[model samples]
Target: MNKQWFVVYCKSREESRAQLHLQNQGIHSFFPKIRKEKIIRGKRSTVEEALFPSYLFIFVDQEYTNFSKIRSTRGINDFVKFGREIARVSEETIKRLENACHSINDLKADTQSLFKSGDKVEIKSGSFKGLSAIFEAQDGLERSMLLLNILNQENKISFCNKEIKKAES
Candidate 1:
């Protein structure tokens, strides 16, 4: 019998743990992971997290490995199923997922940030260098909108992230 892919259900946030247990048992498994970036405490940090939370893929065949031990394995909830019908994933599907994740492993969460409205900021460069402004919002990954009161009217100006820095009060 050809080895078919099956989805393993793991406990909450236990995909890594279950993957390790299966590896020790000589089972072939794939736990797709991705790197995510988050802004915490006004500083940015990157974290490696499971692409499919609490789920991993395992290759199985009736003639090769005994699938019975999977359910009893620590950190494993069970094999994913639909009303007693076990789910089987095709090899092509798994391969596609592997390729997709590999391509984005080095990419960052460009649109995520810790900045919010009303935060004070200072333009570090360009025409408004060293000027203090109110942080309006992040326009995109590389741009932010700041509010500056010019001529007694609020003027919204967009600045690239590289051109601005958090101003200390």
Candidate 2:
């Protein structure tokens, strides 16, 4: 059976526990995380945590048998719902989201925000890593941008449609 990505709604504050329980049940899963800054009692701190709290992704053969077992598990709130049905994410969407979480872990402070105008930039990571440039313009509302790089004695190249942001100086 082909496995599809399904969203799971873990109990409030029990996402990790649910993940563990599902793992023990031989289910493959993933919970994408990000580092968030919080102030608790006048102290600021950064924490590595889930991007979507109480939500986890599971890859499984979607069947009533599997669904029933999942619903019976401790710490499971419910399957993420869309209308009257469980919401399933496309493999591409899940893959990109997973990449964003992982990528952010290695990100520098200056580059945290997605591409912005007038920011010094570079593709320090991903398929286009090591390409350095300056963000002079954006292509659309999705934060994608066009960048200019100087190479080979003042020659300039413009990335027509690129997803890049400010790079750490």
Candidate 3:
């Protein structure tokens, strides 16, 4: 049987733990993660979070691997399935995900901004509360540049991501 990639559903916040258990059992698994900047209590910090929370990928030959053992692995819930058929991911898809993870990891930690240029956003706090703006660029880890229209003039302003949110379409 050819080895194929399959999706595994893991216990909440247990993706890393499940991957470790699978590795210990000689089962190869892939858990993609990305670095992100987050603000907590006015402090900026970098965090590595799972790209697909509570899920991971495993490579195995279904005909030879012990499905029962895999399903019962510590920190693992079960294989993702639709009805009775197990979910399978193509090798190309896995490769693409791997490449994307690598590219993101290679970029500077603060470069992982949530909004892009021309993105519609709303100021949720501060003096600009109840106003809409267009995201211009990320100033730093916590501050972002936005284009706001006020008094019949287009003004560029900076605000924290915490104070801005994507405008509802």
Which prediction has the highest TM-score against the true structure? 3
Give lDDT tens digits, candidate 2, residues 23-122.
9999988888886656668754567788898898998987534697897788898888889988888999988998888787756343225556667777
Clashing pairs in model 3, backbone N/Cα/C closer than 3 A: none
- Model 1, 1-169: lDDT tens digits are 7788999899998888888999999888999988665666876556778989989899978577666888888899888999998898999999999998998784432323546688888888898898888888776455778998778889999886767777887
lDDT for each candidate structure: 0.81, 0.71, 0.89
TM-score of 1: 0.63
Question: What C-alpha root-mean-square deviation, in Å, does candidate 1 show against the real structure?
Answer: 8.9
Model 2, residue 30: C-alpha shift (Å):
1.4
Query: Taking the candidates one at a time, how many backbone clashes does each contain?
Result: 0, 0, 0
Candidate 3 lDDT score relative to the true structure: 0.89
On the 0 to 100 scale, the lDDT of residue 113 in model 1 is 59
TM-score of 3: 0.66
Clash pairs for candidate 2: none
Relative to the true structure, candidate 2 reaches a TM of 0.59
- Against the hidden reference, what TM-scores do the models get? 0.63, 0.59, 0.66
